[model samples]
Target: MSKIDEYIAKRSKQSADFAREYKEESQKLQVAVEVRNLREELGMSQRKFAELVGKPQSTIARIESGKMNVSINVLNEIAVATNQKLTVRFEPVTA
Candidate 1:
């Protein structure tokens, strides 16, 4: 491969890794905040909410504690069960 091609490949891999990590962290933070807000607003215990959502109590605890990587679908289920709004947003990067 050309030197420029190699350089581009290296940088692309680094950028991809950074983007993946950032998204994972962002999603986790979002879920944590949403779960806490919904629980408090409803005055519901973790176990109670878990039962309502059909998720494990420990999973709910982990999610609220920022120790779980929650998927968008799972979070949507939580939002639906709790009657709370869980909104996600993204903006294009500016050059």
Candidate 2:
């Protein structure tokens, strides 16, 4: 294969990998929506929630926007801040 063709092929593979990773991450961010919902249900603003969680409000914003990576620890912190508990379930992806 020509150099340009090889580069294109490699770039396409990388893009595919990135897209798949992003999809998985975006799926995980569904939890962020839950966070927002629960917070709203409890009548808390973003800033207040951030203060309670000891995180920057921007961090909460980014998580709500699904534009940031949040770990289980951060989620737990958010839970505690909201006076809620965090739960995780691992189920195999059905084919």
Candidate 3:
């Protein structure tokens, strides 16, 4: 592995709490990126997207900023608003 990859792997194995927190935060950031990308692709601002999703602008801001725990209901609302379906799956994490 590369140096950074090796270091992260070693740290993750040595610190269980750090590994869990890192995984959680990574997932949150990934979702936030996807949300922002979709909104941008649709040429919509956060305010317009929030209105379409029936959520407050602050809620969208929080979600997009990765500062909020997203719920399935909210995700579903966003999907419907964007004419997409929310699909979730589980897969093995590659090191």
Which number leads on lDDT? 3
Q: List ranges where model 1 is wrong by over 4 Å.
A: 1-23, 92-95
**RMSD of every prediction:** 7.8, 7.7, 1.3
lDDT of 1 by residue, 1-95 (tens): 88965765566577988656766776788779878888878888998989999999999999998889888889889978877666888889521
- Which residue pairs does candidate 2 place in steric collision? none
lDDT of 2 by residue, 1-95 (tens): 88965765566577988657755675768967887887688788999888888999999899888787788999888777667878889878431
Candidate 2 global lDDT? 0.78
Clashing pairs in 3: none
Off by over 4 Å in 3: none
The count of residue-pair clashes in candidate 2 stands at: 0
Q: What is the TM-score of each candidate against the true structure?
A: 0.66, 0.71, 0.91
Local distance difference test values of all predictions, in order: 0.81, 0.78, 0.88
Instruction: List pairs with backbone clashes in candidate 1.
Output: none
* TM-score computed on alpha carbons, candidate 2: 0.71
Q: Rank the candidates by lDDT, best first.
A: 3, 1, 2
Which scores greater on lDDT, model 1 or model 2? 1
Better of 2 and 3 by TM-score: 3
What's model 3's lDDT at 21? 83
